[model samples]
Target: MSTARDVPETTGITEPPRATGLTEPPRSAGVTEPPDTPGDPAPAGGVATAGDRARPGDAVRWRRLSRRMLVIHPIQEVVRSAPALIGLLFAGSSQGGHGHIWSLVGLAVMLVVGTLRWFTTTYRVTPQYVQVRKGLIRRRVLTVPRDRIRTVDVTSHVMHRLLGLARVEVGTGRSDKKDGGALKLDALYAPEVDRLREELLHRRPAAATAPSPRRDAAAEPTTPRPTDQPDPLPVPGNEPGTEIELAALRPAWIRYGPFTMSGLVTAGVLAGFVSRIASEGNVDLLRIAPVRQVVDRVGHEALWLQVAGAVAALAVFVAVASTFGYVLAFWRFRLTRTSGGTLHVTRGLITTRATTLEERRLRGIEVSEPLLLRASGGARLIAVATGLRVGHGAQRGGSMLLPPAPREEAVTVATRVLGTSGPVTAELVPHGRAALRRRFTRALAVCGAVTAVLLGLWRWAGLPAWTWQAALLVTVAALPVAADRYRSLGHTIVAGHLVTRWGTLVRRRVALDREGIIGWNIRRSFFQRRAGLATLTATTAAGRQGYSVWDVDLGEALHIADRAIPGLLAPFLLRAGQPSDGMDPDPGTDPIVTSPGA
Candidate 1:
């Protein structure tokens, strides 16, 4: 069976997995139930833990965060408030120039609040669960069961690097919609981060929850065991698996970075920053000498020439910004498999990051290609694993298997990771004519709205005739977008995976494992119902917790779900000539299977 990092170490150390790091000396020392002394900070209750050192009274130990946070937090707040501070400084004599006074008070308040978190936050690792306690006034305590852990992410920003500090986030296999996806420990002594990560994942499942009074005579002698306990327990993460290098960033791949669209975001941020500064300073951008010169030169040029110049400038800006962001985030990116049965990703320039994902937690992966990236013949890979952050944030997308790169390279990496060529490259079954017509209808409605708005402005608002003409011409592009979106809709079931591909601006093909699907949702909008189509959404406890195949024939949607999980939907479906019992075919069997490790 494929298992998560079965090795007891987070770094993939090949130690013979152990049930208890609890040495024989401790047990033999006549310390039954881990003696509680003066410093014992708990009631005599907690779930039994499998793999950990038997340090006297702490079935778990409370650990404090590093003191270095007191410095780091205040510095971060100061930097964050710099823009606001500058604006206040320029609030000027017209308002009696007293804004600086308010800014000072604000900065002091921020510093205190930021620094207070360090003193308030406390966390600990125990046999049963990982718990974090924080919030000075509210007294919030977040607890997550250890067995559900799926990913460990460690990151160090520029300031953190200088101080030998790192932040760690432990993901508890919670869906993004759920509260408390991770328990974060900010500003830990860098080396402690490693030790903590290893300890947390080192857990092995206990042999048995209830040891029977009647022992198996034959099995007792035959299964000679260590730990000498009645149960020769099977731990969750202690299954055997080998590690291998999967993929790594190549220098040539950097050429595609500009097409990743990260640049466009950076451009927007830069523009916002510039606008904020100008507005705060009460300065007119057009009054600047360079700005005036550029405007005059462009105004005097032919209309086509002016348009071409503006496009060229914007392209240059985006390219530079994109390249810079790419290098900053992925300079030395490397993806490798560690013996612990985890996929380890390490990358970054100024702020380094290391993310470890248990292989068993991976439900599937997403191969995405935005419009520009597709045009540039590139694609990216995102791992769809439980507890693997799913958004664009740096802290979240630790699941990024590959940045934008050649489509062929992406396909190869995906094939290797998923371990099947069939699902990775199989041709998808397309949504038929009704779905196609629906796409066109939506597209035409959008174009019609835009054309109407432009015509109103040209006639009633006295705008130039060219305005409506340009809008009408631009609306025609929506037709191609509609076609592309329809063409993108397709899905197929192959090799234990349900592959669904869709989207126009960003085409995404997701290959999700059938075993991970917990349930199936059938959705039909009013328009969809009229068209005799439905959307099949596979609900899993992993990735986004849901992946949907849109605009599919109703019967086919049922077929896809049934094929994905043989008996899952059988209870709900109206089988041939059979009356509905409103329950599963097998009444005694549990609908939810707990053994797959999902």
Candidate 2:
């Protein structure tokens, strides 16, 4: 067997070896293998060893990012701050003295920062970890274990596309509170990013065998046979099996965008912009001839009619804006399954983004149906996977699988993506009367408090008496909401999946894999205890980390936990009439409580 001292510190090779159909002579017992020369071709049919790829040395060499980054980084910075730059220019113009100089100073500062960031940063990939070093005054080095890496996302904006560059981000499930885990390389050659992604995410097949030389017949009699050896662990970047197209954008799906809340969001943004511009005393849109004409035309109309017309106009504006925004974001959306069970999603019209997620990291799937979309039998699917919560923003790192597709289509896509044949929609077990009572009680308390406040305002603050009627209407509205909330609470287990359903206006049904659950947490508040209800939380490394089956019976919760993972909760459970005191149960034959449903 070769020893540690036999390995070379550095290979001194310029490029990776490729298959060229030639074989090198075996090295002598203690001799280190020489690195392949710059122009040398690799032996065909001969696989390169780990040492041939990453050269182990006393100190790993630091590799700088592609020099193209110097130009790309500054352009990215300027583009990101273009709106701020425009505002600064406007402010400077108004101030008159040296405003242009200040703008130039700001640009200079950004250029300097971008330049320094490029020069100081260096990264190196080794067998065990991917390391990055940066900072001019206070040096910082970030090392991420290869095994911990969960996702490799490639994103490119217009500027990046123009320069033939892409940004690569490697994520581990853990979020970095300060700099979002810091494994991002801002600019690299697009092809290199693709190679890096494959290197980081691919899982080699277990059946692959390394090349071996035959031993002498005399010594072979005492040696173990190759067939008796266990399979080797999978290696990254060794195999990408096949690619399968899963979903793609359809023209018909565009109609669903107007029904989504995205329209309301766009309307709110427009309203805010108009309000800001008006507040600045720069331009009053209402003073325009067309606007004045419309206002005058509606001036003589009934108050209710005028209000109705304005609402109609706003709705039209919102719908149009939302449709445009949606098309821009998902114009050419495509979901594809690549080799080694990885999912690839590519979308966006102007600035395209490609996200890769390994199948092993996925815990479950969530189907969300808002009130409007549910009426049309439409739903959105989100992947409950690890490494999705890397950033602190609401974006949540590319969890969306289907955006407002037909419910049936969404289910079909989900089943295919999860590699399961069972019915995606399982028979749900309702959280009985106790949950309903809790919902009603909470709703009643909220309505009563609001009514009391309105009564106070009406009496002492001299508000109109109609406010009391409005308060009554609000109180009555809570009943339907409470009823819907109660109707939405349900959970079930089917075909190794835990199906959980909840919510009213935005109903969500999640199908979580039983094997993915790592732990169980049973929680009961004072109110829940009084009602004999307990919340059973299934903790997993993926998909929001923990999903709760709320307001379940105490006995049912324990039974569910025990049934989900047979031996996990067995030791903690005790048989009836055994003991009131807690004691460790026998490991070999523990009795588990089971109901008919279980």
User: lDDT: which candidate is best?
Assistant: 1
lDDT of 2: 0.69
Models 1 onward score TM values of 0.77, 0.77
Estimate, for each residue in 1-598, the C-alpha lDDT of model 1 and write its tens digit: 1112222223322221323343333332211222232233333323233323333113333445777788898888888988877667666435887887878887898799889988787766544456666777766656665667788889999989998889998876655445456778886887667656655553323322322212211111111122113222223433322235577788898888778767878788989989987996778999999999989988999999999998888898898888888888887887766545677788888999988788888899889988988998998888988776676553346988888889998999899788787776999999999899999988888777888988998889998988788878877988999999999999999999999999989899999999888888878888888898889899887777799999998878888888989976776666663322222244345476444455
- Runs off by more than 4 Å, candidate 1: 1-60, 83-117, 135-139, 176-180, 204-243, 392-395, 449-468, 571-598
In angstroms, the error of model 1 at 27 is 12
Clashes, model 2: 2
In the range 448-490, model 2's lDDT, one tens digit per residue, is: 7888888899999998988877887988998999998888888
Clashing pairs in model 2, backbone N/Cα/C closer than 3 A = 21-44, 22-44
Backbone-clash count (model 1)? 4
- Candidate 1 Cα RMSD after full superposition onto the native fold (Å): 10.4
Pairs with steric clashes in candidate 1: 5-340, 205-235, 205-236, 207-233
Candidate 2 least-lDDT 10 residues: 1-10
C-alpha lDDT (0 to 100) for residue 340 of candidate 1: 52
